[model samples]
Target: MSQEEKKSRNGGRREAEPERREKKPSRRRRRAGISGVLLYVLFIIGVSAFLAGVGWVAANDVLALNKPEHTAIITIADGEKFGNVIDDLKENGIIEHKSFFWIFSVMTKSKDKIAAGTYELNTDMDYRAIITNLGSHSASRQEVTVTITEGMTVAQIFQLLEKSGVSTVEKLNDTAANHDYKFSFLENIPLGKATRLEGYLFPDTYKFYMGQDPLYVINKMLVTFDAKLTEEMRQQILDSDRTIAEIVTVASLIEKETDGTDQGKIASVIYNRLDHPNAETAGFLNIDATIYYVTGKTVTQADYQGVESPYNTYLYKGLPPGPIANPGMVAIRAAMNPDSTGYYYYAMNSKTGLHEYSKTYAEHQQKLASFGD
Candidate 1:
């Protein structure tokens, strides 16, 4: 009786264990499948929402108003209508949709608050650029450059300054003639002759913003020149037994007469000419710079025949009224201490940047003739 009862109970327990394990596995599989289906539905809904937004933005500009870039600083000029302003932004590629910008403008209630003036507008402008630029000013600053060569005349310098947004050279020319510069060299200038400070203004590159004052340019150049021409240099000029004007005058002539190496010696010859009356005929500076000064043009055969100013050494004697052009440091140093040389006649070959120096006129002429090859 006990064996039979034990066998029946064991069989029932075995069947129940198998059924419980199987049911547990089936429940787990069903739960996982339901979770997977829910996740796929959510993914499809997210994709559809994204595509709908893209289409809406493409069709209507109003959605563009909500874009973050709309608040950027985009300036709109005065008296322009909202539509025209929007069109300008669109043309500049700042706004992708016109309707978006209008909606933004209306939502922000800035339609009438917009001011007129120069503006800075860029591509990322969404609603920010429209409203930000609508406020006055935000214009991009422009780049400016000014250049003056080493030997430009005051007139030339003035023209350059004006062109670079400095005051016009004509105004400065008038001021110079009226003794407004007030420098001693300028003070004694004859009524009809040009004004002072022709050579005193140093030449170099300069930069300034648009609408720079004419006086600012003049002061900057003069300050630079004075600073470069230290007290020690001025004393050296006085020691040479020449006034500042005479030193610069001779230096200018030496600059134009000889080619490269002979500048110092050529300067010495000019000093010698001043010392010895016959040196004019012997070494005879016969300088072309004097002609350039008088005629305000380089030498040509016809100018010699035309009426001449006192600056012309061919027709007149001594240095001209002022320096013909701004002289570099080389010419200034040459005038201070000229080279020791007996050679007097000097000529530069037109084709080459070379010079021929001769002790006698015949030798100089021979060198000039030989220069043809």
Candidate 2:
């Protein structure tokens, strides 16, 4: 190598020598000695400086997003991506730090595990709660449920209402029985002198608001029912030229026969027999439901044939004067939509709960006897 190159290499080596010398602490005593006390003093100053710097950075890094003027629910859906969730939290002022959320999600490996749904995120949430809600799935809905069991009379329903703190059952019954009430669906029989509506109370678990009035509760049920019974059903009745009330009356019969299965077929047979139009001058439907209503006690076929009422299809019938009980959509639909068949008589099989369908009356009579009547 040339002299310049040699000198440059020597200079590089010389520069590295000082770094090596500086790397180790000085072991050789100076003319003046450096004591251990001085070293501890330096360490204390350095630590204090470092702590002060950290406190300053943390203080400067802080920022608070203003809260909502009026609190509102913010839903973070299930299986939602972390990036979008951060945006939602920020947008709703539930959170201010994107970095903190991002770091938490990454460190916890929670990217794919975040639940799906409408989460109840509020401004009052702490940072941990905010993260927790985002990571889970549950909808925010206000629903209060009340149950109406099968075969409950309007009076019973009223009692249930009072028990639930909606209103006194007495008041509800009075309202239902009241002729002057605005809800005219009750108290107006199309062709009969029936005292009350028993066969029209649809059974199910009903949902209502906590403080809702009786009228609102009743109206919601009625509206839901009207929607369920399609317009086509109404049209079919109109085409058959049967009054709306008559269809309801038959629907009550089917509803009564149904606590067992084969409900649809048995219901169809009743319509078929009725279609003959006074062939028996009202052969009794002799349905178990009608007897159960009057006596408030369950009856079998043998105990059944003896009772009589205008509502009793067995005693006299074209159709009852009005609905015997509140029939649900299932029974009402059966009445409106009967199966076209040669089935003139049908009876429920007590053992299997299946209907034994027959075209002739004699076969049904034999089956009825076998029913342990």
Best by TM-score: 1
Give a tens-digit lDDT track for model 2, residues 208-327: 544445555554444445556577876888898886677777777787677745557866777777777654424556566677667778766676557767755667655666676667
lDDT of 1 by residue, 1-373 (tens): 5767767978845334444544456788899999999999999999999999877875444334444432122335557788988887777556787776787778888788677644444344446545755663322334366776666777777777677665676766765454344344444556543346767777677655455444544656664566577789888877867777777667667656654466787876676665665753542345777676656767774566464676666555556767877776678778888888776667777678676678766888898898885
**lDDT value, candidate 2, whole model:** 0.62
Task: Report the alpha-carbon TM-score of model 2 versus the true structure.
Answer: 0.53
Per-residue lDDT of 83 in model 2: 87
Listed in order, each prediction's TM-score against the native is 0.56, 0.53
User: In candidate 2, how many clashes are counted?
Assistant: 15
